[model samples]
Target: MLGRKLNDRYEIQALVGEGATAAVYRGLDLRLQRTVGIKLLLPYVDSTTRQRFQREAFSAAQLNHPNIMGIYDVGEEKDQNFLIVEYVEGEPLYSFIPSPPQVVAEYGRQICLALDYAHQKNVIHRDIKPANIHITPSGQVKIMDFGLAITPDSKRLTAMGRIIGTPAYLSPEQAQGLKLDYRTDLYSLGIVLYELATGVLPFDADDIGVLLLQQVKKTPKPPSELAPEIPPALEAVILKALEKEPQNRFTTAGEMAAALQIVLDGGADTRTTIQPAAAEPESAPLSAPAEAPHTGPIRVVLADDHRILRTSLAMFLDVNDDINVVGEADNGDQALEVVRDQQPDVLLLDLNMPGLGGLDILPQLRSNWPDVKVLVLTGRDEDVYIMRALRAGAHGYVLKTIGEDALVQAVRDVAQGNLVLGHGVAERVVQGFVGRAEVTSNVLTTLEHAILTGIAAGQTNDEIAQRLKLDPQIVGEELIELLDRMGTASRTEAALIALRRGWVALEDLHNIS
Candidate 1:
């Protein structure tokens, strides 16, 4: 479509991406002499799809913030609806992971600011993922794609049968077909942050069903367990955001942003070395400066199950002037040993390590050495994992996918007692709690209750339907109807409420055939 002018103004340059509902194009606005992104709905989309598209455009148009991509116009030409948005020139935030602690903190701060602004406008970005977050050359972060966004007052366009956003980043309430609010977006953002910091998803399975089950039932491993160098304060912030119950998460995006800023301002009061009392000694004579001394190098330790990763990290740190790799370990147990012996300024840990898993060691490390900072460097970026890491006392979280510079910077910032988090983690932690609250109190249905019982008994929907001799679609529809009646936005929330009310049992549901 490049060079093709639409509506006598926009000159299509290239295809940026495509989805089931619409196609996004890179285009030049001849009138404004600036590049813009155009999202055009597929010409043949049904009325429902059209309505959703229009809603997305309208929701985005209501938001005006530096961290959010601006909507210039929404229009239709030749029966195709399209929206023009500010073109971000840089790469996605996902591409810049494992950034230095400072960079991670900065990115997180910006994302929180955007979220706060959007939430204040009563818009919830249901799709909060790396693909939707753009980072400009100047390091400014912009959130895009309100295509799956939902407003409190907005009408539900899709039928109960359809799932709205990506499953991997979905909140428990969303997965369960419950009503949503700003917290839903926060939960998704938490997953993004986890992924950005650790390069891994918190929950992984061979299939989507299993993944969703884990999302609703299992708890995440702490970030500190994965990366020992992360600070406890930072980890606390992440855990708070990832709380399975919305009431446990930050109440607003602004609150989350404020927490991140506090971390960045060195307000993280994490425990450091335990000092023992000693007798005062006579003061030594002062000496002149050998030369104007430079700041001390940022100390770090590398911990992973792979030997090659440790070696590579060590080699990489050797070349950086401000960073120094002081130790290496092959697993969580080994990491603990190294921490005890070397007490490095930062620890880069892996989540799925042998012997003691990263999550298993987080509490131990935090309890034993509160002063040492941890930076989780892993492959998982799920809300569960992000929450677990935060709970375990990680100070910073960066994914393996991050570049060398960002990783180096993250280490430095965490070592300096700053709470640095990758792009999506902070938002997720805050949203997790709020969304949970909304889903639990607002939505519930009879079919959902039946499914919850089946889930509690470890039964899949198919099995539940089979036991009742009902069609899977019927069961799904009934569940959706129940959720709607309960006023919850997502299925995950409905299940959680059911579980809490003893309407379902986790063991039963987990063991369902």
Candidate 2:
């Protein structure tokens, strides 16, 4: 369609891009003499497809935010329908990723504001990945492709089992085919920000099934491990938005924007690690750094292969006066050695160590150092691993994606002989025991998925009650019954089981708080 005139106004110059449903072109507004992007619904689509195509124009037209791509006109000529939008002069946001995290944060805040405006107008951008966002030369963010947008009042066009967004950036709810809202967009944007800071998507793999499952159950490593300079406050905001459950995420794009502003304003308290204890006057070497004093605080050890991760966690943990990181080891052999030497009260262990894997060493540790409460803290959140860890005598299992506060609590809880399960880990264990067919059958019921999702998110009966507009007492009793039926010991385990069976999704596990 190059050089072709449309509606006697837009003169197509060159093809910009082509997707499964439409093609974009650089065009000139004949009357106004300005550049524009003309997105045309490709020929051969049925009437329903054409209607959906026109819906994009209608959806974008209602949104008049600066960061949103502007829709100038929706027209048809010679049976070809098209949308005329403002031409952005730069590449997609993905091209500029691995950028300075602060820059990404600034851009993220703008994207949030734009989303807030659209969401308030009742528009949900079902597709909100990096490719759908454009970054102009002036560094302005322009959200594009409202093609997949669905208004709250609009009829549903997609089939029940069909997923409509990119898998890597998909929220757990989206992957699970649950109803969605503005938080879905925020979760995707969180992925974009994570990639920007860490130079990789949080959940990625060659297989779509693997990617989707990972999004539903697995948690990514902390960004600081990839980019050591990244501030904890910034990582916290990004991780919070990425929560599997929508309620666990920032309530609104505006709230997310404000949170980013705080990070930018240098409000994240990240002081980790205490000065080593002062040496005795006779034992002073005068050349070495001071060591942390052994003052009867909860003695702890960190075991992970990543140096930056160890340092970051140690620093974060050291900030608590009651917790002291007595030793750190990168591999399982080193971990065993350190644990044997220090005899720390608690051990934070990773599964995929080089010399000896966490699984390989767990039985040995249980047999030998039975007194030390081992808490599995790793990026792996699979049911098999979680169950294995528990069976091997681990006191707790926590994912790397867990919040700092949760990490602290897990250590203390496990040290006191209380079993602690990370946000997604418990749900997976629950699913394994319940079996898949039963879980799927339950999710097929209306709003049953919502209840299950609430559980997976670790919500209390009253919280789920308020969210679904049901009676708190009834919700509580029903959950108790579910536990009995599922043969789980507690609500948390039931939720985790539902998660493992894929009846409950990680996105629903809003463990951010």
Candidate 3:
């Protein structure tokens, strides 16, 4: 059919693309001397297929949008049926898959606007896939092929068990051959964006039968899991539009476009459920750097060995919308990797992890990723542990026993540069440092009591010995034995232990000094 003239005015130059129903050819309009795209129906198609082919021209002609392909003419001669359309220059949208979140959202917004315009005119482009969309060099999105389009009053031409659109992009209702509305187009658009953002389909199978069934039954993996770079906000919009029930999807294409707008505006964390924290704060975050303030939802990465607890925390925090669990880790090594890759604003770390314990990596995190604030969330409230973590550069300390609401608030507090201490942590710090005035020493020998009091009051062994009228060597030897017997690692730690365990009184230290 190359170099053939249709209707004596348009000359077909070459076949540009082919599909199951028709072939698109590069054509020249002799009357206007302009290049145009000519879509010709294959002669082998039955009458019903021919009617659908003619319907594409009529359906697409009704819509006028920069993102949509324009239909110019339609005719039939000598059993050849053809339509002329604006010749757009670019590869199919599929070629640009696995793009950055911004690129995906940009094209997605354009496609949504086009679909909304078509839907407003009562036309539903049932086939909304990457292959049916085009991207030009100038970055314009052109939606093509309204072959499977339908109007509210159009006839139902589908046969039972026969899927009308690409299985991978089909909405669950379309997969089940159920009646469709404009939302069906939204569902298909979701699949296209999911693929473009992640470079993979949400649902796919080798067999057509299995593929359609998967679309109806399989819940897709979240796009962010495949492409960690995808912003949480964009992923939320994609997943919402891919809902199994049409009613669960975005109510309109325009609404989905607005959601994408948030991601494009650099507020990649702004979501549907919760608004971003106010940029202007009543008080500046204590830990905020001097250069610029962080905006958007507080991006957090949780590192805990407890899978159930991690999942529960993720679900809880995600509901807030202003706090996204951008990344998660079940061990310390994974924590480091996630922080390096995700660069989250907050790292909720556990002290008792299996490998590379929290303390093991706390100082490393402090020096290597100083910008990321560390919050130790553990059950160890002992003063030794608290001081060690805080001294190791932790910004806050929260116990696992904290209420869910308090935990959320603690995260927000830490993000804003305020230090957080779990309910009893502060009291424990005080009790473990300042000896109880009324308590008397009873659990230690006289020499041990004197030495412990000296250590608590920040005195050295030589000073304790001189005050106690004992040899300096004797004080040193006794301290070594005490350290072993009490199972304490250092003099400071022993001091905290004596005070915390209520083994010594404040009066004991005054007697030695």
For candidate 2, write residues 1-513 as lDDT tens digits: 889999899999987555434677888999999988888876644454576787787898899998998999999999889888888765566656677666767778889999999999999998887667766656677888787799866775641122455667888877666677778899999998999888888998643445566777777788899999888888999999888778889999999999988876774322222121221221110111122222246799999999998999999999877688999998989999999999998999998888787877899999999889899888875544665677677877788888776677677656655456666554454444334223435443334566677767767778888986654644665565456667776767776678777776676565422
lDDT of 3 by residue, 397-471 (tens): 888988776677677657756456676664443343233212344456556777888899998878887887655
What is residue 276's positional error in candidate 3, in angstroms? 33
| Model 1: lDDT to the true structure | 0.68
lDDT of 1 by residue, 133-169 (tens): 7666566777887767778777665432334566677
As a TM-score, model 2 comes out at: 0.53
RMSD of 2: 22.3
Off by over 4 Å in 2: 159-161, 267-513
Weakest ten-residue segment in model 1 by summed lDDT? 282-291
TM-score computed on alpha carbons, candidate 1: 0.53
The lDDT-based order of candidates, best leading, equals: 3, 2, 1
Q: Of the candidates numbered 1 and 3, which has the greater TM-score value? A: 1
Candidate 2 yields a Cα-based lDDT of 0.73
**Among these predicted structures, which one has the highest lDDT?**
3
- Deviation in Å, model 1, residue 21 alpha carbon: 2.8
Cα distance off (Å), candidate 1, residue 172? 1.7
Please rank every candidate by TM-score, starting with the best.
2, 1, 3
Flag the better candidate by lDDT, 1 or 3.
3
